[model samples]
Target chain A: MKSLKALNNPLSTGQKQLDLLHKGTSETYKPPLFVDTIEPTGHFPMKAKGVEVLQINMGKMCNQVCKHCHVDAGPDRQEIMTRATLELCLNVLKNESITTVDLTGGAPEMNPEFRWFVTEASALGKHIIVRCNLTILLANKKYNDLPQFFKQHKVEVVSSLPHFSARRTDAQRGEGVFEKSIKALQMLNAVGYGSGDLLLNLVYNPSGAFLPPAQASLERDFKKKLKDQYGIEFGQLFAITNMPISRYLDYLVASGQYEDYMTQLVDAYNPMAVEHVMCRTTLSVGWDGQLYDCDFNQMLEINCSGTKNKHIADFDLEALENRNILLDQHCYGCTAGAGSSCGGEVV
Target chain B: MSKSYYEPSDLGKFGDIKDFQPELAEKFFGYYNSVFQEGALSEREKSLIALAVAHAVQCPYCIDAYTSTSLEKGSDEEEMMEAIHVAAAIKGGAALVHGVQMMNKAKDMSM
Candidate 1:
């Protein structure tokens, strides 16, 4: 892992990147703005329908630097949720309206108090989701029992396995990631995690600059390949579109695919998908307890679109619900094609 | 004014053909739309075929459009490139097969 300061310097200087995106959205190559495209469908300025899911970005400290990671999470990242912030989240969960807690991070498991937070959240009887990177469970001896811990809590584990093949997965993520991820999946399966009662969902984002194949078709391929090759099983597979932000944005710019990719996203905007976007139902809590409409907005540092109650400490359900979700060019990623969200295709 | 045989911007204005011959343009567009629609072949399968034809005909506009279309329709790079190779094989084979005509003509002349 590189030093945190070194890894984050580019992000601090990323205003140029943002400007490039802005130019695309506002000037040349304009398809209708994402918000405008949805307005006629009565879904513009997208508001939270309800807080059914509370997605907590535990921190930016991750075990690997995946190329398309919108979180820009890597081993060098030092951001971790403090116990105090976790307590605030737990307090919010007491409301019962938030029925699910979706935990994400560089690797949510890397947080020192991660299990404690999960244990307490599970006691609330709410469905719990952990966006596991798979490799982290195999990264260290202390973290090896993550599968058992998750099973005990009955946590729904959603992991990224970009492809079932080693070459593609390792290309997007780091070297040997696919092998470690397979081992982690087998370990989870051994504990009955992928079978009945325990839900082990695998996430697939494209390895290059393209939308994922239809979730149903891709899931069949994953099921056959994983079962035939490694004798693995899982409940569901989620096909996620790579959000054009953070490391992926950097890749787009560097590879000269930024404009074309954004054009594709804008051109493929699906109004039907706008109504069910994750941001409509999920409140993303950042590492420091700040709030955003979704995790991609959190990475771009776009706060929730409101004048008040922008942090978990100041969480007011009514006020938060009434606030308009922020809009930007990046919003196209969520609305493109079949529509994309943490749960996979919306439409 | 400046002049060039092919203007990159012309691709975006493809719909503007209606301004000249409205009925014919409309008919052409209708035919084009129907052609791409699913029939015996799926839209994805058609897009792959269009991509292969784009390369064989060396039409930059078709190449650009069908490449993106194929991707949107869920074709991976490997499959898409393989489609191009299929085009390449036929193209190369067509030229080589014509050599038999030249061989016969040369033998006749020499005799």
Candidate 2:
């Protein structure tokens, strides 16, 4: 885990990660049996668990254009959730029983209303999670104070590191990202973020077309490496599978790894992971306020199904719970092995 | 469609040996799978060892398989290259050690 550098796709900056299967579309899903379809006992204690975690993609603008970016996010992209849409999301959290407000994006901080949404959601007594891309904190002097702001709101910060080595991390994310990320992480630690209840977590998705190793052990490696090398400390590690979408999918096809990667996903598909996939509990809201089963679907423009409540304005916890979750090839990125979600390791 | 004696895709079908001999292949594969599980030497370590052995045996298929395995298991490039070097050192040492026999034969034959 010294250099695990997870892709954590829009791959949760709404995902914090996903992978692609290039060739076969053999096992068509019967609306992929999401746990919401079944009676959720609300017993699962995993983070981002339960019928909550209102994940909103704040924008598609980012400081870095990662190689496996599922969002295809970059500086040129101007799309972002407006304050109006964020108000609708806040309204849903206000009335409905949603417990977590997960903010992600090309870089959620880049959104004009990002801090406003977090403050409003925090005021609502809902737990907040920010899928930070560590280097963004150092992207500009204006954003430099992000760690303190995050601490003030008690936001759970989940940033993708991809790998611990500078060369490899730079290869995937951008030049000098690893150094800046380290500085950002140290700043977060200085603010007492990764200690006590002020949570700070790291995301590790495979840089290439491969599944992540075990999470718990990987977390241990990350802890040792960061602590040893940089005296940095964090809470946990989320090992997300890289979803084949956007830039990642494009990489797969160009490199001719798509077919083999897809075969790996198909072979490693764990039915046990299907029931607890993030879409079952977590509702994905795009920048424009459209709803989908998960972030992957949001990227593919597969809106909320089996119900008409497909936008933040038409928010309906009951209807959404009863709706059939959409499924496709990219979903295998979530179900393979222990399962990948915003929280990481679903099973 | 295969045009070579060693098709890389065949590695994906290592299980296909079962199609020809179900009983024996099943037994061998059962043991093979068990052999690679988390044992005294972690799976990552085993993968590196497999890589070294693959080089020693010069098995293209195993080299390809274990290289990918080692990478996914969190072995960095340096670590993997070091493993290969270990195999190379042994192979080189084995040949040099045989030079002692040559020395003995030369001494016995003349002078």
Candidate 3:
């Protein structure tokens, strides 16, 4: 493991983002008591309902390192999933009754065998969902044809567009990212990816330490703006609340807003949102094939609640079905407002 | 009960309004709840509006409540501060506009 100082020093764009996330995890600031808030609402020890979506973190190699990325993924980080791990994930998907296979990463498409894995997963007659950073498609010549490839595989592409405007989008991502992303979306649109059956979902996470506006309203705004301004189209807009972990955590602490943000999340805790949380119906697989309740937990290095069935290779459906969904201060992000998930607002 | 006109701690006791007049407080709290729900404006939009109103009214209790409420509803610091400025502008403009009346009165008296 690299030391914190070594990984964070020289403060490149990605490194600065990494350093912020690291600084957030320091012991100086106390996270609002997460369990106390939930327990009082009789939603303590949140448990999984069943596994419907198997979300896999393909790798931590991404082109653009967004400031609020929870994965802490970047170009320098070389933690790609091996063929062996991919095989194990496939094996589980093959045998289990899982309906959706959601792929995520620094950019899942960055993995060398990303296409191969998608091909195999698609062959399994499963609903494949890829969490793509649209800028990746325009990052290099080799990746330029990714939109067509996604269309070929019938993969549901869920890309993050922080805001509709370039100024705000580029501010959170990087300079010129908005332009590249717009081009990529146009490419996807050209291939009918956002049309009738080919699902193209856009995700909206707040640029700062705030919850997103209502998903339906934001979706309408995104649809109208993208159509009129850029002649772009998409299926749905998922309004996601930024989880207080990783890069975002670093941001809150650096700006002296960590405590306030946590308090806000705690205050907005909606008991009704607990039952429909993605963790209840989804399982997250890390790059190394370790199983977690959700992606945020995987980032925090929190494994599944139980001692057994911790790895995807040793996946036991029964053990996992009974496993308690791990809870932490970060869980507040998911339960707040209408609730947040990979599928967007749960409630 | 204390010497100061405003007690900082009273902000936390906002719910204690019921203790003074149960019927009116109940009705007021009920209306407040209905006002904040998602409808024509989202809970988030309402929070921002509330934060602006809090500043305009110069209510310390409402300022603290709505500031947190605005953040809870997912309004960023930039947006929150902007909302405050909107309030400040309106409040300042209201006071400034009243100067026209003073000017008119001075002209009449001088004549």
Candidate 1 residue lDDT tens string, A1-347: 34323556464333544565676533556555666777898876677787889999999999998888888788778889999999999999998789999999989999999999999999999899999999898899999999999999999999999887787788889889999999999999999988999999999898888887678766876898799999999988888999887778877777888777887788888888888889888899999999999998888788897777589999999888778888878888988888899989999
Error of 1 at B35 (Å): 6.4
Question: Candidate 3 chain A, which ten residues in sequence have the lowest lDDT sum?
Answer: A9-18
Q: TM-score winner between 1 and 3, please give it.
A: 1
User: If the candidates were sorted by their TM-score against the true structure, best first, what order would they fall in?
Assistant: 2, 1, 3
TM-scores for all candidates?
0.83, 0.85, 0.79
Clashing pairs in 1: none
TM-score of chain B of 1: 0.92
lDDT of 2 by residue, B2-111 (tens): 67889887897999998999999999999989998877766777889999999999999999999898878766677789999999999999999999999999999996
How far residue A262's Cα lies from its native spot in candidate 2, in Å, is 1.7
The i-RMS of candidate 2 is 1.5
Query: Where does model 1 sit among the CAPRI classes?
Result: acceptable
lDDT of each: 0.86, 0.80, 0.83
